[model samples]
Target: MKIVESHKTDVDNYIITHHYLRSAPAGARLRLWVKDNSDNVIGAMMWGRPTARTYDYNRILELTRLYLIDDTEHCAESKALGMARKYIRKHLPEIRGLISYSSTGEGHKGTVYLADGWFAVGVTRAAAWNKQGRKNIDKSQKIRWVRSV
Candidate 1:
C-alpha cells in the first residue's frame, strides 16, 4: 500500500461513510489516503489538534480519524501510519509528536497503534460535552497513545 496526500473533503467523506462513528473530524491539519498497488484508495487518516487542553497543540497532533476498508490487506493500517509519521517528520518540522485515542466503548484494543510503536500513556476519564452543545456524546473512557514524529 502507498500513502499519499489527500484533500479534506475526500478524506472526510470516506471516513463518514466507512468509519464506525459515521462522522468526520472537527478539524484536520493533514489528511492522507492509503492506496493499494492497483491505485484504489483503501483507507484514510485525519490529523489535527487534540481536543484536550492538556496537550501542547503547537507541537502535538492527534490522529482524529483513521478509516480502513474491511477488505484491506493485512497490516495496511500500520504501514499507512508509518508512512504518515515519516511524512509529518519531513513536511511538518515543527511537530514533535503524534497522539491518538482508542475508545474502549468501541471495543478498540489499539492494535494498529501498538503495531506502529505507539505506547499507551494513560486512560482519559469519561466526560460529557453537553456544554459544547453536542448531545449524545460518546463518554466512553479512552486510552491515549503517543509516538514521536
Candidate 2:
C-alpha cells in the first residue's frame, strides 16, 4: 500500500464519517489516503493542529484520525504511518514532530504508534463535567505517543 495526499471532500463521506470513530474532520491541515496495488482506497489519515495547547504548538501536529479497511493483511497501518512521516518531512518541513493518541475506552493501545517507533508519553484521563441540576462526570483515557519528523 501507498500513502497519497488526499482532499477533505474525497475522504470525509467515503472514509472518515463512515469509518472513523469521530465521524467528522475538523481543523484538518492534511488528509491522506492509503491505496492498495490496484489503487483502491483502503484507509485514510488526518493530521491537524492539536486542540489543546502544547509546548511546541507551532511545530507539532496531531494525527487525529487513522482508519484502515478491515480484512487487509498485516502491516498496512505501519506502512501508512511510515509513508505519512516521510510525506510530512518532505512536504511539511516546518513540522518537527507528530503526536497521536490511542483511547483505552476504545480498547486501543497504540500498536501502530509503537510499531512506528513513537515515544510513549503515558496515559491521560479526560473528564467532562455536566451540570444538569446535579453533577455528572464523563471520563475517558487515552495513551499518547510522539515521534520526531
Candidate 3:
C-alpha cells in the first residue's frame, strides 16, 4: 500500500466514479492508494478539503474517502487511515484533531477509524449537502465521529 498526497491528476478517475463525488469535493486532498503486487489502486482515501464550505472546520483533519476493495491488502484500511493521521500530524501539525462522518447505512466500519481512536461525536439528524438541484444525501441520517490528533 502506498500513501501519497494526491498529485491531483492521479486521483481524478476514482473520485469521478462516485455518484455524489462532489460531496467530498476534492480540493487539496491527501490521498492513499493500496496497490496490489500488480500495482492496481484497490483501496483509497481522500484526506481533506482545501476549504470547508459545507462541513464546519473544527481544527481537525477531515479524513474522508476511505475506500478499500475486498481483501486487496488485508490491512489496507487501517494502514491508510493511520497514514492519513500521521501525515497530517507530521506535516500539517497546525491541524488540531481528526474528524469524519459515516452513514449507519454504510453497514460497518472495519477497525480503520476505530483503531485510530476515533469516537462518535454525535449522530447527525441529517447529512447536509452543499450541492444544487438536489438536496442532501438520501442517507442523510449519519453518525459523526472524531478523534484528537
Each candidate: what lDDT? 0.89, 0.78, 0.62
Better of 2 and 3 by TM-score: 2
Tens digits of lDDT, candidate 1, 1-149: 88888764888888888887777767799989889999999889999998888989999999999988889888889889999999999999999999999999989989999999999999999875554665535679999999999
* Index of the highest-lDDT prediction: 1
Q: Write the per-residue lDDT of candidate 2 for residues 4-114, one digit (tens) a residue.
A: 887646766555454535454467888888899889888888888975585466788898778888866697898799999999999989999999888787678888888
- Give the Å error, residue 17, model 1: 1.3
Candidate 3 lDDT, 8-71, residue by residue in tens? 5455557546424334455544665655567676756676742335654545557666666676
Q: Pick the candidate with the highest TM-score.
A: 1
Model 3 ranges with Cα > 4 A deviation: 18-24, 36-39, 49-58, 109-111, 127-130, 135-138
In candidate 3, position 145 carries an lDDT of: 75
Give the winner by TM-score: 1 or 2: 1
What TM-score should be assigned to candidate 3? 0.73
Which pairs of residues have clashing backbones in candidate 1?
A: none
The C-alpha RMSD of each candidate to the native structure, in angstroms, is 1.6, 3.8, 3.7
Per-candidate TM-scores read: 0.92, 0.86, 0.73
Candidate 2 structure, TM-score to reference? 0.86
Model with the higher lDDT, candidate 1 or 2: 1
